[model samples]
Target: MRAQGRAPTTDGAASATDTRNALDLAARPLGGFEAATAGFTLFAAPLSRVLDVELSALEAQGRGQIVSSPRVVTADRVKAIVEQGSELPYQAKVGNGVSGVQFRRATLKLEVEPQITPDGRVVLDLDVTKDSIGEPTAAGPAIHTKHVQTRVEVENGGTVAIGGIYEQLNRDDVTRVPLLGKIPVLGALFRHRARRDQRSELVVFITPTVVGTQCETSGAGDAEAGKRGPEAGGAGSTRQPLCQ
Candidate 1:
């Protein structure tokens, strides 16, 4: 991540005294005065995914081939799996043995743009997107997407928290008990079924701070220390000026 602070201008800082005076003013407590006439904008966003998996018997024989059944789980068509007939059993398994479940990770992306106002205010524009594969419907595995866009204004040196979006996904698994599990309606008695639901959330946080404020404080502290040097029995010792 890049820093959101502006660089100091070097137009015409001719004298050390002028520089020190500038630092002294910028270090002053906030009131109606402007501190170095500058400020900053901050942006942050959190992305997370929760995955749940459930396994169960489909109340029928678990087909080990890529059948046209909506319950059949396979890789994306773009990267579709091309397995031989001998590999069907291995590919259909959800675990060490063919259990009948599939899982995929969801993706989230965030984009933010910040603008600083003259009165030390910050404006933020945010965009968030999430993508995932949903449960099989009448057709097949459904593609799910969630999007969020918003703009807000915040005072300098302050923080803002914003909510994005949420989504839920599900996966199902099936299993059977040898030949007994295929006895028509009686098959369901020997099989097990399970399901998993995954929920996701996105939250964004932002903070803004003025640039050069740290430098000003350090400069002012050193200048104050120098002023008290003589009183501390260091009258003969020379004190360096701040900011030069």
Candidate 2:
């Protein structure tokens, strides 16, 4: 008969040790791999009443629309592209006196990397590029571009304004005694020509919201989900999440 109090076998002891190690590992939180995720909403609009208006007010007035709203993991790069124009082919010299037609894309692109700080603020590394086809030149159509690279920090659910991008409109109005304005050469004397130069600023508003954390347990995630409002992911809302 075996003794009532005998030491466990080596295999049993190793198995118990492995079970304890597994439990300990499971209890440990993920380290740097568990980065927080955020959702960013960007709006590009004319800087009219938007400067005084709140973001929701601006949206209600239809002065601005959401150009991009992306859910990105912290420290990861994300790109947003909104191309409203088409690619145009232009003649370019490829090699030794060899001219070839090349296509250029006119688009609005944004590259962003967001990092969450320990204090719960979000830091954004933003690159904004806006390209448009301008008036035709002697060679081909000109490409007008505006680019801005910046890094900014903001609290969660806060909006930041970026300016310095502008658009100019030139108009020539000729007012004369009706038929006199249509006269040939002599119409210059009777016509009153006026030039109006209007400049408008393009403002970009970015809002970031921390949505979730990778290390959140299921129970905590559920609790957070319950705390979210209808705007998060509820019904009757056509807008995307984190955008509203």
TM-score against truth, every candidate: 0.37, 0.53
Candidate 2, run of 10 with poorest lDDT: 1-10
The deviation in Å at residue 124 for candidate 2 is 0.1
Give each model's clash number: 11, 0
Highest TM-score scorer: 2
lDDT of 2 by residue, 1-244 (tens): 0000000111111112223211211111123333222222222223322433444544465544444333433332343333345687888999999999888988666656666777876666666676778999765799999776666665566555555566676889978988877889998888898998765545455555666443524565545555685656475443322322
- lDDT string, candidate 1, 1-244, tens digits: 1112111112121323323211221222233433322222222221111000100111122311111111112211111111111111112355666566454434444454555566756554545455556556643456576665655555555544344344455778878899988899989999988897655433333343434421133766667877777784376765443442
Q: What local lDDT does model 2 show for residue 177?
A: 83
Q: What is the lDDT of residue 205 in candidate 1?
A: 36
Off by over 4 Å in 2: 1-85, 174-182, 185-192, 216-244
Give the candidate number with the greatest lDDT.
2
lDDT values of the candidates? Answer: 0.40, 0.52
Cα deviation of 158, candidate 2, in Å:
1.2
Model 2 RMSD in angstroms = 24.2
